[model samples]
Target: MTDFRSRCIAPEPLAGLFCAIPHPTGVEICAATGPDFLCLDGEHAPIDRERAEEMIRAAQLHRVPVIMRVPGHLPDSIAGALDSGADGVLVPRVSTADEARAAVAATRYPPVGVRGVGPGRAAGFGYRIPDYLATANSRILLAIQAETPGALENIEEISTVEGVDVIFIGPGDLGVTLGALGPEGRPKLMAAITRITKVSRAAGKAVGMFCASPDEVQGWRELGITFFLIGNDARHLADAAGAAVARAREGF
Candidate 1:
């Protein structure tokens, strides 16, 4: 398995595309597209554990890291993704330091955290249990979403939590919180994003965010965001298909 956590903290920037289609083939295609990692969306997408594991396997085959955005900051939610062989779990709606710590603990085993032992795919189906256990705590990456006003207020404290690797900003939800969206709200959203990135960097943590376009990615990159989850598979497909149809209608 790729040591995604190590790559995340490396000096170079890490870029990843999101997958919301819940299919291994889509994940494989994204991995082949050559991003540093791929984030499987379980929070907004209808991906179950089985499908998530399949996607992880696909990404692994391509030697690309896969991080799942689990639905919430719950033990089962976080563990399900890790146990499914995901390189890490991105817990959404993490609004406080305690919530961030809980998300981190869920990804680890006892003493360090409360994750239970299981001979699942992550352990190579019992064959690599000893090896897996020996390094799982440190190997597994943990990220929490800083998407709401509450999360923004406690961003510093959350970033300081031990075991937390990334602090991802959810711009859409954040815009909602700030009562700003679209072009009119871009300034406020950008300000919040900059603040989150600065705070996370100050705490020695990686900053991550979602970007739908190259322009957005460039903008965030300039602000010192090394970890990026770009456009999802579904949107990419739809956009391509729509463009293709439009070209055909234009008769070359």
Candidate 2:
């Protein structure tokens, strides 16, 4: 397993992409391209626990770390992802410190948080349970999204949450909530992004974002984000296929 939690806090930017295609083959394709990590899109895709485990296995074949973007902060969702051997989870729609706390809690096992014990794939099916449980609390990365006005308002408190690792910015959702979409709202959107990054960093947590392209990575990195999910498999396939058809049509 890649030590993805360590990568999240490293000074150099860690670039990643989302694997929303819901298949091990789709995950393997992205893994072959060599992203720093891949986030399984459980929140937006039709990925269920079984599919997620297969996807995790596919990424692990290439030694790529996998983090699931679970549908919610519920313990069941978090536990299922972890049991499948995902390196971490990204909990969406976190709007307060309490929500952030719940996310982290669900990722960890007692004394630290409420995560229950299980002899799943992460533990080598009971064989490595001792070691897996011993280290899981520190090993699993728990990132909570800062996408709503409530999160922006409580950025500091959320950043200060004890076990929260990364404060991931869901730009689209955040913009929608802030009424900050389009060119006219760009400034407002950026301001929110900047503030989240700054505060999270100040509290000693790494900041992450869902970037539209690689071009956006460095600009955000300069502002203190070190983790990024740039684009997704579907977009890549669509763009390449569309361009090929467009070029072919030019000859017609």
Candidate with the greatest TM-score versus the true structure? 2
Residue 161 displacement in candidate 1 (angstroms): 0.8
lDDT of 2 at 130: 95
TM-score of each: 0.96, 0.97
What TM-score would you give candidate 1 relative to the actual structure?
0.96
TM-score of 2: 0.97
| Candidate 2: tens digits of C-alpha lDDT, residues 39-62 | 999999999999999999999999
Alpha-carbon lDDT of model 2 = 0.91
Residue 191's lDDT in candidate 1:
86
Stretches off by above 4 angstroms in model 1 are none
Each model's lDDT: 0.87, 0.91
Q: Which candidate is the best by lDDT?
A: 2
To one decimal, what is the Cα RMSD in angstroms of model 1 from the true structure? 1.3
